[model samples]
Target: MEAMLEHHDGIALFTICRPEKRNAINFAVMGALEEAMEQAAADPQVKVFAITGAGSEAFCSGGDLSEFGHLRGTEARQMLMRMGELLYRLLTFPKPTAALVNGTAMGGGCELATACDFRFAKEGSRIGFVQGRLGITTGWGGASMLFAKLPYGRALDVLLRAEPMTAEAMEACGWVDAILPAEHWHEQWRERLAPYAERSLSVLQAYKAAAGEKWRTAWFREQFFAEIARCAELWGSAEHEQALRPFLCKK
Candidate 1:
């Protein structure tokens, strides 16, 4: 499976299951994620929705360049818009959401974390918004979400630096809610999330609705779509193509 969804103890854990590719998001993975989210949302027993990757080496590397690097022009725009929509849905999801960062999370992976209401990262994990390294801005509405969720300077630092930051550093910047011990992180996350999961679904949904109200505003949606469009334009640009060569060659 490119992705797997499991329901346990009122939590729906959606895992990206491609350890060999660092759990990167490919088209099939995207579809699976969407389906997982839908399934969790419709299940009355599911009080919380969470995401994670399959293995210890990486939470997610980002979009799979091996599969997506060949896309250009409208193809790129459509792909970016699809993921952007998914992230937006996650940000506005009625249930409480979390990202369990077991290892490195870069580029769109960081964006995925940003979309969640809380982020719990392993002690040794690293996180970064590194789309700048590819000569494009975040196409999944991650940058806009980061700006809304974090202080301006800190959000800019993560995006502009284009380098990975340790879990401690991300915690310091308020991006990470907690840093779990590297050993038995799955058990630790389950323990940590238990309290939230125990809450009534109505209570959790009400709080999430209030917290995500701004994301539903017309202004925010306009700005987010604008960002996605800008990124799509850059995705077809000479600079982004040139920057992607080194990464693609490795594939």
Candidate 2:
């Protein structure tokens, strides 16, 4: 499986397992992730959900363009909608979600981490919203979510610049909640999240529910979907198509 899920105590860990592809997301990985998330949601014993990538080289580089680059127009729009739905699920999930950014998280990978309630990265990890270089914008509702989590100017800078920043830099900007040293990062994350895992499921759900009240409204949904539509329109553009080919070839 390109994605794998493991459950221990009250924590569910989802790992993107394709290190050779820099843990990029493809249809199979998305499907596996959805299933894992569904399982985690339905299981009363699961109190905290966590996500990470398999290897140290990258948490996730981004979408697997080799698989998705051929899509155009409506097809690309549908792809954006699909990813949006998954990210929305994560963003408003009833349980606390943590992203273990063990390495680099670029483009959609950064979006995935953004959707989580907490983001903890290894000290040397890098992250970015590098879609500009690919002739696209953040398609999975990342810009809106990022703005909600960070200062408006910083969010704008990150999106407009489309540059990779160190985890330390991002934490300073209030995007990354925590930055851990490379060695024993996983152990440290466990210690940090363990307390939450021990809490009752009902308590965790209630707290998340209260915090997510604003996001549960229709306005946020509409705005998120609108962004997806906008990105899809750009996905079929000549600039996007031209940039995509070279990026995939280099990968």
Candidate 3:
């Protein structure tokens, strides 16, 4: 399975399972994530929704270029919008959501983390919104979500730098809620989530709805889609193509 969903102790843990590819997102992973979100959202027993990657090497490396690099123009826009929609769903999910950053996260991976209500990164892990390096802005509505979730200057710093930041640095910047020990991070996150998970599902949903009111607005949706469109335009640019070549070749 490219992804798997496990329900335990009132938490729905959606794991991206392609560790060999550094847990990159592909169509299969996207489909699995969507199904998992739907399933978890409808299940009364699930009080919290969380996402993570399979191994400690990476939480996610973003979209798999090996699979998606061939897309251009309208095809690129369609693909970008698909994940944009998913992240928007996550941003407005009725239940509390968390991103368990077990390892490094880059580009779309950072976008995925931004969509969550909380982020828990393991010690020594790093995160970067490095899509600029590829000549594209955040393609999946992450930049919009980041602006909503964080202060303007902080969010701008993350995007403008386009380089990895340590978990400690991210926590200081308010991007990460907590930094867990590298060992037993799974247990640590579970413990951190326990209080929220112990709450009634309805209560959790109510709080989430209230906290995410801005995200549910049509105005926010417009901005989100607009960001996706901008990134799609960049996706077809010559600079992005040039930058992608060396990265793919090295891979």
Candidate 4:
């Protein structure tokens, strides 16, 4: 399975399971994630939802270039919209959501982590919102979420520089809530989430609702879709094609 879902002890764990490809998001992975998230959200017993990638080498590298890099115009638009919708759902998911960043998270992968309510990183992990390096803006509403979650200056810095930052740096900037030692980061995150998992589902939902109300507004929805549309238009641009060529060649 490209993505695997496990529910146990009132927690739902979603693992992106393609370590060889750095757990890049492919169509199959995307579909599985959507389904797993739906199941977790609907299950009354699930109090916490945690997302992580399979190996320590990477949490996720981004979208799978081999699967998506060749698309253009309308096809690219559809792909962007599909991913945008998925991330938007995650951003507003009712349960307490956590991103366990075990290693590198780049581009859309970083966006995926940002969509969650809290992010915990392994000691040496790194994250980068590098979409601009690909000649496109964030297509999954991550930029919007960053603005909502982090200080304005820091969010602007992340978007403008398009460079990776160490987990330590992110923690210092308050983007990552905690940084655990690499060897036992998985256990650390589970402990962090344990308190929530023990809570009643309604209590968890109420806590999420207080913050999620603003995100659920129609104006925010417009901005999120607008960001997707903007990136989709750029997805077919010559610069984007040129920028992604070397990566596509590696694939």
lDDT of 4 by residue, 58-97 (tens): 9998899999999898988899889989999999999999
Q: Point out where model 4 deviates above 4 Å.
A: none
Model 2, 1-251: lDDT tens digits are: 79899986788999999999999999898899899899999999899999999988899888898888889888888888898899999999999999999999999999999999999999899999999888899999998898888999999999999999989889989998988888898788998799999998889999999989878789988888888888999998888989888767875
Model 3 poorest 10 in a row by lDDT: 242-251
What is the alpha-carbon lDDT of model 3 when measured against the actual structure? 0.93
Q: Which consecutive 10 residues in model 2 have the weakest lDDT in total?
A: 242-251
Please write out the lDDT profile of model 1 over residues 1-251, one tens digit for every residue. Answer: 89999987999999999999999999999999999999999998999999999989899999999988989989999999999999999999999999999999999999999999999999899898889988999999998998998999999988899998999999999999999998789899999999999999899988998998999999999998899999999998898999999989998
RMSD of 4: 0.9
State the displacement of the C-alpha of residue 89, model 4, in Å, after optimal TM-score superposition: 0.7
Taking all chains together, the TM-score of candidate 3 against the true structure is 0.98
Q: lDDT of model 3 at residue 38?
A: 94
Checking candidate 4 for backbone clashes, the offending pairs are none
lDDT of 3 at 21: 93
Off by over 4 Å in 1: none
**Candidate 2's TM-score:** 0.98
